[model samples]
Every structure is written in C-alpha cells, then in structure tokens.
Target: MTNEFATLSDFRALLAGAALADADMFAAASEHNMQLTKPPGALGQLEDLALWYRSWRGGDNAEIAAPQVIVFAGNHGVAARGVSAFPAEVTAQMVMNFQHGGAAINQIARVNGATLDVVALDLDQPTQDFTQGPAMSENEFVAALQAGWQAVDATADLLVVGEMGIANTTSAAALACALLGGAASDWTGRGTGVDDAGLSVKTQVVAEGVALHGGQGDGLETLRRLGGRELAAMAGAMVRARCLRIPVILDGFICCAAALCLAKTQEGALDHAVAGHQSAEGGHARLLEALGKAPLLHLGLRLGEASGAALAIGVLKGAMACHASMATFAQAGVSDS
Candidate 1:
C-alpha cells in the first residue's frame, strides 16, 4: 500500500517498498515433491504451481483459502477519439452489471469461489485526453492508485486484478509501446470490436500517445504519464499484493500492462504474479513474453474486469489441491518402479 507521502520522492519510496518473496518454503516443497510417489516432475505444471504458492508464502504448505478478484472500473477520455465500438458510458453500465451479478465475471467468480470487488474511479473526469496534456494531475493518479492498493484483500491467498474502461486498450497499448519500445501498430488491437477505420484511429492514437510520452522515465513514470485510472489502480493492487505476500493472477492485456508497471517499480514483481491467461488482444502475448510468464489458460478471453483470472482460479485451486493431497511414496506403499 502507498505510504503517507505527499511528494513524488516520497511516493517513490512507497512504491519501492514492495517486498520480495522468501524461498524457504520453496526449498522444502522441492524436497517433498521429489519424495512423492510419482516420478520426478510427473505433476508438471501442478508441481510448479504448488511450489509457487509455497515460495511466495514462505511456508512448506499453502492453500488458496480465500480467492478474490478486484476489478477497477474507470472511463477513458481517449474514447472520445472513437476508438471503441462501445461508448464510455458502457464502463459504468458494466460496473452495475457486475454488481448485479449479471456479467461474465460475476458468474465465473461465483463458480470459481472468488469474491468480486469493484473500485469505481471518476468516470466523469476520465483523465484529460492524453493526446492533449497529461491524462490527470499527479495527485489524482496517486490517490486513485492508493485506493486500489487499499482495496486488495490482505488475507487473500490469491489475488486477481482486472479492469473496466472504454478505450483502455489504447492507453494500455501506448504504455506497452513506451515502456517496451514496441510499435503502436504491433501492440494496439480492436478493443470492443472496432471497425477497420476505428482500428486505424486507435492505432494512431496509441502511436501518438507513446511518441508523446515514451521514454520519459521508468515503468511507473510511463504509467503515470500514459495510463488510465483503471490501469494505474491495477498496478497499485499488484504492488501491494506482492508486498503482502499474496499471490496475484493478472487478467488480460490491460492487466499485464499494469503488471509491467508494477514490475518496473519493483524488480521481480512478476515473481508474485501469474499470467492468468494470454489475452486474444494484440500484444498481450508479447507483453507476457516481456514479463517472462507463461499463461495458465487461453480461450481467446478479451473481456476485462478479471474474467480471465476468475476462470483460471479453479485451475490454481486444483493444482494446489493435488500438491496438498497426494500421498508420498512411502505413505502410498508403492514401489519406486
């Protein structure tokens, strides 16, 4: 969480305080896995998943006791540029839908045993269109990010961060290009099913935004300059979850962009984050690659708001169950054939 600092230097201190994962449990889990009845590395990804939990928790045993998906909702001023098929108002409507238990994220969260939370930012402001000046004042961005960090569940065994906004893809793409030296055309995709012309405009907007603010500073600085409220909040949640030793599963492209920002501020922030899925959006795979993460699932999932992470939580649960339940070779009384 953000510390009580009113200045940029002090804010940097708060961001720099994200803690690292301890490996004592990881060492023990590795030894236990080798002693399990199965062949070495038989469980494949499940073993990796179990070890991940143990490592981050700094314990030999870990379970996803309470899973959560916190969705940060905001509106994007760049949507005025006609980037998305849906208007910015849809962001609020979807927030209502999510609260009403009607959106895809709600259903997935219920089925996967995750509590859903929504942090609605100022849709009315939408941050001054980045194409003009800074999207928002540093004060507004800092406060919104702090709100997100506070929204994270400190007791949660697994944290999944998602976002809701119109034309946020443009912001995410621009941030990606600026921080990773990518081209807008390569990172921008059809968000909310834009037409060919809309795609061109979106691409141009991202390209222009990146050119305007690219290479200005580190990841967090780039995020502050080119990101939307939802994106900034997601980064805050990620950094805080890592600080609390809670594992995080990042949603799609927008989520990954925020994760990249968190990673920049805290080296190995990705150590506490797992890519829930590879988004169908353009540049998500590239972003994941840049973060050195292999997603757990892929279903062409493009709906933001943590839908992908909600669905993937079950997989993590199943993997953790296997690690916690399987009997060792001696317990099973099985020969090492």
Candidate 2:
C-alpha cells in the first residue's frame, strides 16, 4: 500500500519479497470443493478458479463482493510512427469517454457490480520512442509504477487492470519479444484493426525496438526501455494486488504483457492473477502461453479498458457462488456413490 518505490531497485526489492497465497486456505478450499454436491470436477476450471480465489482471499468461503477495475491511460511516442489504426490523441479522448461512462468498460463494470476508476498518466507528455531510445527514464518509470500502485483499493477483493494508450500493442509486442525470446513478427499484431500494410509497419517497428533495446534480461529494465506508462502502471497495480493478497483477472494482450514483466522478474510474481480472456489480437494467445495462463473466456474480444476481464467477473462469481453456497452430499441427502 506504500508508494515508496522511488527507484527500479525498490520495485525489485518489493517483488523479491512479494507474498504468496495462503496455503492453508487453498488446501481447505480444495477439500471443500470435494464436499460440494456436484460431481467431482464437473465444473472443470471453475472449481480450480474458486479455490484459487479463496486462497488469495485467505478465506474458505470467500466471495468476490468487491471487485475493482482500473483503466490506465497514457500517450505513447511510438504512435507517431503510425503503429496503430488510431492516433495518439485517441488515448486522451478515450479517457474522457471512460470518465463520462460512455466506454464499453464502464457498462461492463457497472453490469458486473464492480467499481471502476480511470487513471491518466501524463498523457500530455508521451514516453520516448523506444526505437530511438528507452521509452521512459528511471524517474518517469517509477512515477508511472507508483501511479498504478496507488490506484489499488485495499478494500477490493478482486482487481482488473486495463489500458488505453495508442500504439500500446506495439509496445507490448516489443516487450514480449524482449522478455520472452521471440521474433518480432511472432509477437506483433494488428492492434486496433490495422490493415496489411499497417501490420507490416507495426511488425517492423517492433523488430527495430527489440533489436535496439532487447536482451537486457531484466524485466523492469526491459519495461522501462520498451513499455508505455499505462503498461508500467498495470504491472505496478498487479504487484500491489499481490502484496494485498487480492486476486487479479488480467484483461488482454497488453495487460498480459505488463504482467509478463513481473512474471519474468520474480519466480511467482503473478501467482495471484489469471488471464480473463484470450483476446483476438494476433499475439495475445502466444503471450498467454508464455505466461502459462489459460483464459476463462475466448469471445474474440480485442477491446481493452478491462472490458474482457470485467465480463469474466461473472464467471468467477459463479464459481465462488457454487463453492460457497453448495450443499454437501450428506446435507443435501444425496448419495455420494
């Protein structure tokens, strides 16, 4: 909950000492799952998801009553290179849309009964173009990360961090290629529905960025060099959630990419998080595979702003409902055999 991460080393220290889910609660939840009336493994991943959520919540009968969705917006200098279908100004404009409750995430969060907050990080001043140099200096990176860290509500039981930054997919692709050891084309995608020519341009930009700044072998350093402000904030918020033992449902490719930085940093930095959905973006599936995350939904969603994760809240809610409210075989007068 403290925003004292003044330097990248501070972040490293926090990550190194990050907490894990309550093992006792996890075991208890697992045993409780067996006592439920439903056939064993009938709910499939939902059963596992419930237990996972309970472990982090540190309660045998924990429910996601207070879920928080945060959408971080920032402008990317890389957008100047024509990496996205939309202009960089769209980032700020979309932030306004979110504030006015006109965006898809607003409706999704409201319908799911989750509180939404939008954070804009220095949109008036975009990060440096990574193809030329590091995207953000140490101070800038730390500020962005602290913005994300401070945005988390300690009272929330669940967290979902999304982004609204133009050319951010390009940034995510570059970060992925840098951290996960892949070619740019393998990680690049036509974000925001770019055409064939635009896709090629985006891919080339990713390759260029990676070739220039890749191989640092440090996740935070790679992020400072290649990630956007919103991306860094998402990483920070996820770390904050881990520290608070709040479970997280990651949004899309960009969100996963932000999480990858943390995953690559510590052994189990993302232990409290899960992929909300596999996005329609070309690189999202590969990114999820790299993170060892199986998404809860796959509705071909490419819209960010935590929309996908917000929708998947119901899925977790359903799992928690069954896990918490279901009667045991003996109580229901049902035969175990």
Candidate 3:
C-alpha cells in the first residue's frame, strides 16, 4: 500500500485538519428518532449512538452494511522481561490463527458481517527493549503508522482496529502513563494473566520506561518510544478512518492507548470514534476515563483481537436498524399522545 504520510508532521497535519461530522445529518437523525413509535430516549445510549453514527455517515438512512476489522500483530522485545504469561512467538502464532479463522475475533467478525484483515509487522524483528531506549526510530514508527493507514478499506462504512502483541499491554501502560501524566502503577495491569510477582515486574518496567521516555509532552514521540508497531498501526488506522469519515468502535486498553496518542496530539481527533467496551485489565477503566469515553459494554473482556469491538458492531447495527427501519407514529397508525 502507498504511504499517505512521509513523516510524523504530515500525520499531525492530517489530524489537525480532519473534518468534523455533518451537523445537518445528525439533527435529522435525532428528529427521526424522536418520531419513532417508541418513546423519546427509550433506547438510551443506543439512540445517541445511532445519531452519532449518522453524523459521520452523513445520511438520514445510514446503515452499517460494510464494517471492517483489522487485527495488527507485532513482536515486542519487552516480552523477554517476563511482563506477560505468553511468549513473544505467540504473536505470530495468533496471527496465523486469525488467518485460519480460528480466533475469537474471527468468529466475532464473521457474526458481525465484517471483513477481517491481519497485518503482521516484522514479527521476526522485535522492537528494541523500551526500558533501554526508544522502541522504534521515527522512520520505523512512520512506517508502522502507514501500514495501519493503508490497511483501511475505503468501502468500509465503519472501522475497528485490534492488535496481537505479547507484552503489548505493558507497552500500553507505559504509553498511557507517559501521555496522561500518571504514575506507572496506576496505568500498569496484569496483562496476559500475569501472576502477582509478574505484575510487580510489569509495573516496574512501565515505571522505568516512562521515567526514561515520558514527560516529553509529545504524543507521537512518546508513542514511538513506548508503543509497539501494532499500537502505532492502530493509531494510523484510526486517523485514516477519520479522514474517510468512517466511524470507529475502539477496542480495549491497547487500542485505547494507540488512540490516546492521536487524541493528545489533536483536539477532537477521536470525534469519529466510540469506546466499544471496557476491558477487564486493571488500567483499562482509567484509560477510558482519561479519554472521556464511556464504554458501550463492560463484560470484563481483555481479549485484544478486537473481539469486543467486533461484538459491539451488533449493538450498533441494532441501533441503526431501529432508527432506519422502525416506523414513525403516523406510519404505524399510532397516536402521539
């Protein structure tokens, strides 16, 4: 795929100039929702969700017919530090499982009628251990972002980006701590089912990485220093989705950390996206709170393959169906008392 951005500056420019949702369409959708046979606000958050979707889609009859899920896989050198319960090679093996349709995200995507694409980024060349130094150089970081930007399908009306990387949750914690100005312990969590001792190690690693790389006040730089290739790609995909006016259902902690990079870089950068669900990861709730995003579901999920977001697609589709297909009081021959 062609590179849309040659430098982080270019990407930042795109984020700064990204278009906002269509107000006219949003107003129309809100009015139509009130006219439905059901009482106003009866659908609760679904009502707002449908309207928010319509605003980006720019139509009174917007429907989620073409949703796309992209799962990015990358190896992190930090896994060698015993931050996770799984080996780094599991990232590549899980990518294969996704390709073979054997993963939970595969089944969830299929059920949501969404096409899935898996992008494996240099699994053989794991990033540098971030505690020692930056995870990726600027060129490598830009390349990862372009990988995510090119992975998006223009035909897709909605987008969901996920990741598969061992020790990525550690990366996410460090990234979040660097961006959100919190202690490492507040952002760190037991990723991949790490035991208590492992969690302590993970927390210390996060602290060290953030101490070495944090407080730069540059989101992109922090992302390059602390985030994985897959995390960068997820950030890239979300930016591309914004440019295309495609609404996104953000996944869990890792996905949110990637998004936080964009959000911190530009105001309203995540205006086209919504939190799909809150993960069981200890830091996920804090991340969501920082983003000012209330998750649509909270089933204690921490599976990172975009499983939660893909499943939330059904919830969005249900909202769209009720908004676009349900009859108004006049059409249903019901009195509007």
Candidate 4:
C-alpha cells in the first residue's frame, strides 16, 4: 500500500517537498495584468485567481480543460442509528443518481462542460460505526484512499471532489473536532435537514466516537476513528491532484474537512486547491479559515455533491479567458491607467 499509494510519511514527504506554481509565470501574469487597460487590482480575487492558474500551469496562456468532478459515495455505519434525516439507503440511491446524471451536480457539470463520475466505496462490509468502534482498519482506510488515487484520470486538468453519504456530516464533524480540538456541538450541524432532536443525537454520536478514540491519533488514526470512506478518498484525491499539478476546487464542509486532514498529514496541501464556496454548514467557514482559503463564491450552498465547485468552474474559466485572451493595453491601443 505504501509503495502504490504512499504511506503517511511518504505523503508528508511529498507534500513538504512538493513544487508550487512557477514563479516566473506568476511574475509574468502580474506584469501582464498591469499591462491591461484597467487599473491595478481592478478584478480583485479574479485577478488573483488568474495569477494563481498562471503560476500553477507555469504558462502565460493558462486554460483549464477536461474538468471533472468525482463524487465519492459511501454508507456510514452511524447513519443506521438515525443520525440523519434521510435513510442510509439514500447514499446508494444517490450514487445511482449521479451515474444517471439526474442530480443537481450533473446538471451543473453539464452546463460547465465538466465530466462527472461517482465512485462507490462499498463501506458496509468494512466500516463499522465509529460510534461503536473504529470506522475501519488501517488497511481498509488505505484501500479506500487508493481507490481515490487511482480514480484520478491523467487527462484531467482540473478536479472537484464531492461526497454523498448519509450521516457523513457527523463523520466530518467528528474528524474536524478531533483534528481542530473543537467540540462536536460546535462542529456538527443539521445535515440533511435534521430536526433539533436528530442534530442532538448526531452530535452525541460524534462526541462519543471522539472520546472512544481519545481524539489523539495521528492523521490516519483519527481518520480511522471517525472518518468516512468518501472523506478518505477525497483527501487522497487532493494529495494526488497536488502531485499531478491539477488544481482542485473543493466543495462544501465535508470536502473542507477532508482538506483539513490532508493538511494535517501534509502541510501546505491546501495550497493546490481553491475553496469552491462557503457552505452554510456551521463549521465550514472555520474549516476554510484554517486552510487559509477564501472561497470563490458564497450562495449559502449546503448541498454537497460538488455542486458548489461546479458552479465555481465557470468563474475559473472566465478568469482564465481573461488571463489568456484579454488584450494588453498595447494591443487594445489604449493607455494604461
């Protein structure tokens, strides 16, 4: 597993030594921006996003092509305990929905010209409820991550990770609390539109799970304690995208939690990603802050499945188009301000 997918130490090493976007290209993009007819910093973060892609690709004409979103679907053992408003069956059903392109993510991806795929991480057999015990063994966790690492297509120039698993927000909150020294009460939200009573139960489940594991494991141990398969895969996918130089636009709270885990194991892992949007989830803003990421869009979106990231894809494309095709002041025959 370590050889094929990289061990925790290897992940740490890879991330620590990973190269960032090219410095020369970044300088070039900044210079080119000043050459435009508009005054400096006119486009705000859009200018920043343009420069980021320029540096990421080490090119003056950076363009994102072959964008794809992979939604990892799994069933949480905790969901069987009524932690979610929806039943556990919805996880599997949603996986089918993603494959059939009937979900919101599909429509957004279609409009954005991004391909979508769903990876099912058959969790029932291996994952026990963390509230009862560890979610899975170390080997199982590694296998789940490897699935994500392998699922990344080489042709992909951009990636977005979305997840679907009933009660997953419970797992995400537990993992976040464990990693951030937060409380379940602060981290857990009413996922899937749960009522107050259901939210209370879910929070209790998270607290119990974290307590059972002492909330003191290394990255992998904590993941095994309270993480979901979809999350593990998302973290793995984030790591792989960094290695492959494909920038990832992350979805909502759940994906942010996975990004947190990635950073915990490999510092600066979030540097390769742009936060897609701010989810209305209670813990999402905190997660993005921890990663030092300001999302591209904010529409109170709490619906996961990479929908937020898909919406941001258009923004990214426009940023690139501006970067690559927008005329310089000289070409436009206009004086720079």
TM-score of each: 0.96, 0.98, 0.98, 0.95
Candidate 2, residue 52: CA error in Å? 0.9
Off by over 4 Å in 4: 1-3, 6-9, 123-126
Please report how far candidate 2 places residue 84 from its true position, in Å.
1.4
lDDT of each: 0.84, 0.92, 0.93, 0.84
**180-221 in candidate 1: lDDT tens per residue?**
885789999997899999999999998888878887778877
Indicate whether candidate 1 or candidate 3 has the larger TM-score: 3
Q: Tell me the TM-score of model 2.
A: 0.98
> Which consecutive 10 residues in model 3 have the weakest lDDT in total?
55-64
Highest-lDDT candidate:
3
Order of models, best TM-score first: 3, 2, 1, 4
- RMSD, one per candidate, in order: 1.6, 1.1, 1.0, 1.9
Q: Which 10-residue window of candidate 1 scores lowest in summed lDDT? A: 1-10
Query: lDDT score of model 1?
Result: 0.84
Residue range 202-244, candidate 2, lDDT tens digits: 9999999999998875898999999999999999999988888
Where is the poorest 10-residue window by lDDT in model 2? 55-64
